[model samples]
Target: MGKFAKWLGAGVGFTLGGPIGAILGYTLGSFVDGFSIQDFTQEQEEYKQQTQQRTRVHATSGDFEISLLILASVVIKADGKVDRRELDYVRMHFVKMYGKDRANHAFKLFSGIIKRQISTRQVCMQIRQHMTHSSRLQLIHFLFGIAKADGNVSSSEEQEIHKIASYFYINDYDYTSIKAMFYNESDSAYKILEITKNVTDDEVKKAYRKMAKKYHPDRVQSVGEEHLVGAKEKFQKIQSAYEKIKDERGMS
Candidate 1:
């Protein structure tokens, strides 16, 4: 069987339901032989408890993988065309997740999606409906990294990302915090910590502690190793933000 077909067949053994199922059904219906929602749901329910505890849910799961590719494709085309840098960045992540061969296949799929007009708002709404808040935050963070891969985030890309964050129901504070990681801004350090200069030293420390826990690489166990690696960048940003605050305050 072809790579896409193999991926779909393997996914059939998993609990692939809800919006994710709908999207995948539409995207891969032609390639996936004998695809049945009823059968998949029944099997999924049978193995629900066993899989629930061990399922890595996002990025690793078949549905999540497709969702990531769809969103990533949209982000890649946001600036009007795909840049080699952006493509390489995404390819590297996929390679790490699914090996070179599968990554190539997935990239082909992504490239095909990029060629078409994607209803990004609709996709984000579906993702938000099925994914957890943390998972959605990670998705936005991944998109930001891709935008910065070409050394600068275009105005159009930034606008699209902001729209995505809004659709994900990410609050202004969290959105700005994630943006500060990729974009250079005057109050980036404060924003990364999700705080303001008006806050006291103790509050700064508290914010740092909270952000540190939130963005820690260990928090992304549901995804693959590459994602944990990606989380490290966010974690580092939080650490750097705290250090900057400490230095400015002359606190040892």
Candidate 2:
């Protein structure tokens, strides 16, 4: 069978019945012709959940895949123009996380997703509803990876990412911490640990432990084995930052 045959027709279809699915159907059918962002979502329960502020957990790998694709679309358009390097980064990362065939299907859907005007808040809230906080944090990290794929993350791109983080309910510390990973700077280590330069050595150690557990791959293990690879990369970054801080502070 071809990749398109498996599009939204594979990987357990966790989001195949939700607004994510509806959006996918709409994207395939509409492809931006008289597209009403509200057309498929107005009466959906997801919109209701967004208003009622309820938590609906049990997100599958498929749902995570859909959410990642949509948010990546948002970030890619953040700078008002698409960069081929950024586009390739999305393709390569997806292929790395998922196998080649699955990644190809997702990339095809992503090609369509990029053409439409998606409601960033609505899609994010849908993900926030279904996914655990840990999974959502992983989403934020993946998005930062997308924005930084093309050398530097522009100011507009940064702003769009910050907006998406807010929609996901990720606080500034977590956001800046992930941001620190891509763009290394003087205080990137401290930022990665979510600590301040003026903090005491003990506080730095405490922050390191906290961040280590928070970013541990096991925390996001529920997403899937593929995602754990990304999670481990994040965990290693936290470790590397802690080591750097320890080296500079002479803390044994």
lDDT of 1 at 218: 74
Question: Each candidate's lDDT (Cα)?
Answer: 0.74, 0.81
On lDDT, the candidate that comes out on top is 2
Tens digit of per-residue lDDT, candidate 2, span 1-252: 234544554443345446566767677555445434464354344545544553444677877888899889989998999999999999998899998988988888899889878888877777777688899889888888888888898999889888888988989888999999988799999999998899999999899889988988998867788899889989999999999989998999
Choose the strongest candidate by TM-score: 2
Tell me each candidate's RMSD, in Å, in order.
4.5, 4.7
How does residue 176 of candidate 2 score in lDDT? 92
- Tell me the deviation in Å of residue 113 in model 1: 1.5
Global CA lDDT of candidate 2, please? 0.81
- lDDT of residue 56 for candidate 1: 48
**Candidate 1 overall lDDT versus native:** 0.74
TM-score of each: 0.80, 0.86
| Candidate 2: residue 63 lDDT (0-100) | 74
